[model samples]
Target: MGEVLSIKSILGQEEPEHMNDSMSEVDDDSRPPEKCPHCGKALKYKKFAIGHFTFGSHLEKCDCSGAEAEREREMREKERLQQEEEARKRMKRIEELFRQSRLGLRFREKTFENYKIMPHNKKAFQTTLEYARNFAKYKEKGEGIFITGDYGTGKTHLAAAITNYLLGKYTPVIMGNVTKLLGNIKRTYDDSQYTETEILKELYTVDLLVIDDLGKEKPTAWVEEKLYTVINERYENYRPIVVTSNLELEEIEQRLENCGGAIVSRIIEMCMGVKIKGPDFRKQKLEKGRDV
Candidate 1:
């Protein structure tokens, strides 16, 4: 063999004539070493290999203050992506809940923001707003609200507002007119796609159940049985309910007499009573439209 040169000399200087054919070009030491863009420190060199063959050499990472900052930036970006993914999942879940809720288009616009506040509905409005605001605490305790008033007293509006508020917070809430809800369940008797038990289960397990126009539905034995079952199940499970009715507590008991007052009694125990008294908003609006 010719004079065997040290590895450092071969890399730092020029290669010998004998080794020029086998060895690739070494890094030029005359040129300045590549510096880290972030920290301006000279980058250390690292040789990459595969088995026994040395493939090449490249700059290794620098342990400068800027490196820590880059790591922190990457961590923050990861956290932001995680939060966005969680938000997307939550929105999808809320959409599914809305699909199952049976909330109609008529009530979709009935949010707290749009509810016309008047002297008659002011107390009920304030009460329902507070209930919705502290819904988390009340949900844990299974507390709810029972709203009673004459027709067009904003009873259903307030109920729908509560539904909207909770739904916006990603809480699973179901609200439907009492007549339509019972009608849907009754129709399930003929349709095998859904059973009465399945329908009632949704109502029982939802975070909050809003029953609108409660006394509007005709009281049959079947209706009373279903109503009692839903109420009793939710009551026993410590699930809250929001009821909007034109009847008072006593009237509701009388209206749903087939359940022997059990429905109204449980509702009384589960909810805080809010009675709204006012002129008919719908009638006033109609009159205004006619005048216009």
Candidate 2:
């Protein structure tokens, strides 16, 4: 009886071991298991498992929390690239427009980087820079600058520097020699390609007009009329004009004679005259050349 009881106990243990093996097989068959591609962790969930595809399903179907974060990161990168491309296109457009402007054509090299600022003219330089910094206010007020000084005192340099600075703000500047402007207008009578009206329109409409050697132009009835016309139009429109000259304010009046008062009046009304005093740099260069 003892031997039979021991045999029954051994059979009972073998049956339990067989049942445990069958349960393991059932669990494996219930779901296809695979490892996560990103983390290498075992995944029983079908959505998060590798080698599985779901049609028209959102990334949220994945069990890993990083799936949503990665999607967001990719979207942000795509947006950043798009914004960069837009900015590049905008900059190119701006360059093209500036290149076509009169200033870009006439004074291509008269930029701030090439301007020579002398120690004696520091205050004038600072004032010009400040004017550029506050250009919007000045433009709205129809205010401008009148640079009066001896020859070669860097008046042109400062004026060109202002234009160069203003270009960054997208303002168009036109610089012309007083004599040359009048000459071109006169030439228009014979030349069919350009008209006086068109030339004057550009002078009047530009954001900034810089007249170089203002008082040096030949004083005549025709020249005076044209000059006054240009100045008056700008005055009426409340546009800014920058003037560089070697004559004093009173001297300009004396030179203009009859139209002198009107022209000087407009100049004074529209601009603040800042006098620059310095040794003639040209004379200095000549003297140095002689010594050499």
lDDT tens string, model 1, 1-292?
2322444344565544444334443443434578888978886565543222343576666788898789889999999888767756755653443354467788878899999998878989999999999998999999999999899889988999998887777677778876666676777778646676766677778788888888778888888898888889999999999998888888878887789389988998999999999899899999999999
Judged by lDDT, which candidate is best?
1
Return the TM-score for candidate 1, rounded to 2 decimals.
Answer: 0.67
Best by TM-score: 1
C-alpha lDDT of candidate 2 relative to the true structure: 0.72
Residues 119-195, model 2: lDDT tens digits: 77878888888898898899888899999899988888788878878866656666667776667677778964667
Query: Ten consecutive residues with minimal summed lDDT in candidate 2?
Result: 48-57
Candidate 1 lDDT score relative to the true structure: 0.78
Model 1, residue 193: C-alpha shift (Å) = 2.4
Residue pairs with backbone overlap in model 2: none
